[model samples]
Target: MNRLSAAFIAILSLSSVAIAQSQPVNELSRAVVQVTAPDGSGSGVLFERDGELMILTNRHVAEGYTKFVIGVLEDLHQPVVPTFTAILHSFSPELDAALLRVTMYMDGREVNLRELRCRRNASDFCIPEIRFASDVRTVSRGNEIAILGYPDIGDDELIYSAGHIASILYEEFGGESVPMWFRTNATISSGNSGGLAFNPATGEMLGMPTSISSDAETSTSLGRILSVEAVWRALEPDRVMTTWEEFLPPNDGLDPAMDPHYGGTELAAGFEPDLFEVEVLAGGSNRIHTLPMECTGYVASAPDFRLDWSGETTQLHLFFEAFDNSDDATMIVQGPGETWYCNDDGSGTRNGLDPAITLDNPAVGTYFIWVGSFGEGDFIDGTLRFSEVSRNDF
Candidate 1:
């Protein structure tokens, strides 16, 4: 039998015991998988979005591993014989959560899961809809929760635990207080890090069980679940990308090595005027690259100007000046070391609504610059300025 069929048969054999013991385990445990990481073993919860199967686990469980093994089971105490290989897609340390995508079922054939499907009256291999609670924070203290995961004691088998919410915790981010994690009286162990904590009444997942706190004297432990809000926040493309490599690739269709939209300018430190300016029409058809901060604007696919800088400088100031003072201008600079700098409204430092960015201790290298308007499809006429002094000086 194929790996998927073998897994399905194993699940079916345990359904009888699951129905007698816990109804939630019979239905929801199919989505929980045992994840084997470099450090050790933990659990992961499977979720389907837009026809793709994704797994959610703790960062400590799956982080740093490009690939790992996961075993899917539908009942507690059922051994995970057929395993699948999963790829670590992304991780957010702030949220302490990691996302994985399944690639293939681990057999000698290396069969792809995406290509396999259930046929009418012919196969038991079928993917089911794993539902998560939309209103995650609705359950407060005293609400009963059901958890399914692979604890070390269970070996390769999934384990089910029952508990109640003990308390909710909050953290501040981006000037807002958000739900961070919740403590529960769930019996979770070292191998349960990335499993599901669900509402038994609704059969919907509430959050992920990430860590457990123990009291040696009392011989008791409290489980800490990373809130569902934190999970969604971590999954966001913008918030999860901390490194420069995670930034969005340039889509302007123009190569940085090519000639700029406007001619290139060579500037050296301690130049005669200490100021260089170029007049050009701004805005382009391409949307601005996804930046680390609140950068909203549009620019041409090709850079408007290229700056070849020489020597050391304390600060290099780049700003845009629209002919119409009311026009909202913006700027993008691809500096040395592939670092990106973008500015909108200049943080209100400029005289008007123009955008400005000051690079501190600017390095001597080539800088590809783009000047654009805050609004899309806007071709505002503006003067791009480069100076050693700040915009306040001009």
Candidate 2:
């Protein structure tokens, strides 16, 4: 090769390395926050937009409490802890996802993202808001990725793990099937749930690290990522609270019975029975009920129907059938003495995407049934049937 061509190639390679070094991985690291509960801890993303700040984490991670601490890394891996109380903004337990809004202050002041800092040259520096990939669909298997979180590595330091996308999996929810998850060879531990998974090439978030699977024999760990699209579906505009008053001190408590806006649905006592009713007999045909798009709340949050089954039946079977294979739905049966039985994504014949419940020797009394949409503003035009079955059949 000529001397001039060789010199040009070296200069281009040098510039490429400089550009790669200037990328925003350091700033993205700041967006990963440590979420702590009374029982355990996990990682959450610090989402900030238009002057509003919120944290997104797994539903299981934020379960059982309305208040927790948001930990930001400072002083060379030590955490700056701030206590904040939050209300359940929205959640889908079947999806294992939850969105909580900070409501009140307990022991410390509210989190000021500007003051939050990360370490560089034995000093701290302010970081910018995290960026999310516009479309996860563009991501293909074998693409390089990075997973960042506060893993329980005997310290509070933020851990960054790198791996490649192994495969994409399509799962059904509420009757609709979509490519909702991707598997990676990243190392994720117990505290890595809800952590951010980013495309190293662009520093854009691809998904959240929600689960990990290990082959017992090979000891190979596979990380399961909930796609960013799923996160967007969970953060539907209708489900999000627009005003701050909705999450204030008096409303910050976790009990749905006490908070009217807890899950965007009123409780059982306030709910009136639906106008339509269907009676099912043993060895009888299935009764279909159309769940309109207006059915806004979720399985644990909405009141859908009232059922009276005071017959000489040993067991009762309920099924929620969706119109499409990808649509998702939830069912909750509140029975005698305020007992509750909830099911999401039916088992066996139902492909684990529909809700089904079998009550053996259920109390012979009136049962209030509630159905909820799995997706945001998702109108489920489906059929619901209840049948009396023999105990052995159940």
Candidate 3:
């Protein structure tokens, strides 16, 4: 061969090797696990959360169950078998996602799920972590991607599908529009829900393959991916630092000192007669759609009820009590430091669909509250209650 031709071939060989080294596909695949619940089975991605190993999957896959069987892929030829049991850690019904905390192994050996590394065996070979693309805004249409999961069709083996971004969809939240989910030509099947939608070149997760859209007449199907933005917002509260500004409603120019629409009350940290309440109309012109799968409702610009708190050594509880079952209200509190807290539907037995928010060691400042309606622009009558103890205590 001529010298120039040989040099050209040598450069091409080196470039191919570099490309292969940049993308560690095998390591990324190892993080995928098969999740088996009483109702059905689906895919889950392993990630570290609060010093424990957790599996993230679609909420539908974990329906009506708190405990689940988790299995890790060992090889392609062997079927994935149940290796351990995981407990439901937390769930977001709006986001359609659930987290499972890994418990003890079948062999009785303690495992560290909090560690970044998830091992296939006792060997050093492991998937440290499945890296998620930091900013999904950078992703554009036509970007090539891959989906990894334990699809039912694959019989418990990890399946990989390749495709490209088809389109991006936006949804309105808190009066602003933001990208929510995107359509992809990638093939997402029955068991693909909650699996990783990844960028094969960089080995970064782009989104979660959650559902598939199909046309009856045309017989055409497109995969729908839950964008990382929604996923991040859904998981943000658990993190110490938060990007709440992105999800909270925009300012409507209402001052805190403005007269509360529902009137107001004052309470000290250790005040006697612990519970206080005010009658108010919930909901207004403003809509809070940005908080995906969490708080959703329409609130007014001004505070419905204002609380003059004298600071608290213990946690403070602010909740709404609907007079009847027909009303569903939401609560938004702008407290000291301008921090915002929101909640929809109280967990207490009697609270039902009423909203509640707990402020840990509430600061000594004025709190502006908005008791909102779950429906747009609907006025709801409810009682805004404040207590030092939980609503259940009452």
Q: Give the least accurate 10-residue stretch of model 2, judged by summed lDDT.
A: 281-290
For candidate 3, write residues 1-394 as lDDT tens digits. Answer: 9999999999999999767844466677767888887536888888776677878777656644567788876554467767778887766645766677888776866875434365554343244576878888888889988898888898788888888999988886335565678799888898899888888888887878898889999988999988767766665445311122432334533356668887777788887788887888788876554433344577877788888889546788888888877688888888888777888777773647888888898899889998888865578876888888887877
Q: Runs in model 2 with CA error above 4 Å?
A: 1-23, 76-87, 103-107, 110-127, 173-176, 237-394
Could you arrange the candidates by TM-score from highest to lowest?
A: 3, 2, 1
Q: What lDDT score belongs to each candidate, Candidate 1 first?
A: 0.76, 0.63, 0.75
Report the candidate with higher TM-score, 1 versus 3: 3
Question: What are the per-residue Cα lDDT tens digits for candidate 2 across 1-394?
Answer: 9999999999999999757844566667667777887546788887765555677888767754566677765443565454455555666544656676655455646756555434453245344557778878788899988888888873777788888999998777546776699999988888889888998878888888998888899978899999887777756665544333442232111122332211222222112332122321111111111122212124333234556555444556777666666877766566787666766666763556767778887776666665555543455656666655322243
Candidate 2 at 345: error in angstroms?
Answer: 37
Over 4 Å off, model 3: 1-23, 113-125, 174-176, 238-394
Ranking by lDDT: 1, 3, 2
Error of 2 at 69 (Å): 0.6
- Candidate 3 has which clashing residue pairs, if any? 53-113, 94-293, 173-290, 174-289
How big is the positional error of residue 171 in model 3, measured in Å on the Cα after superposition?
A: 1.4
For every model shown, what is its TM-score relative to the native structure? 0.53, 0.53, 0.54
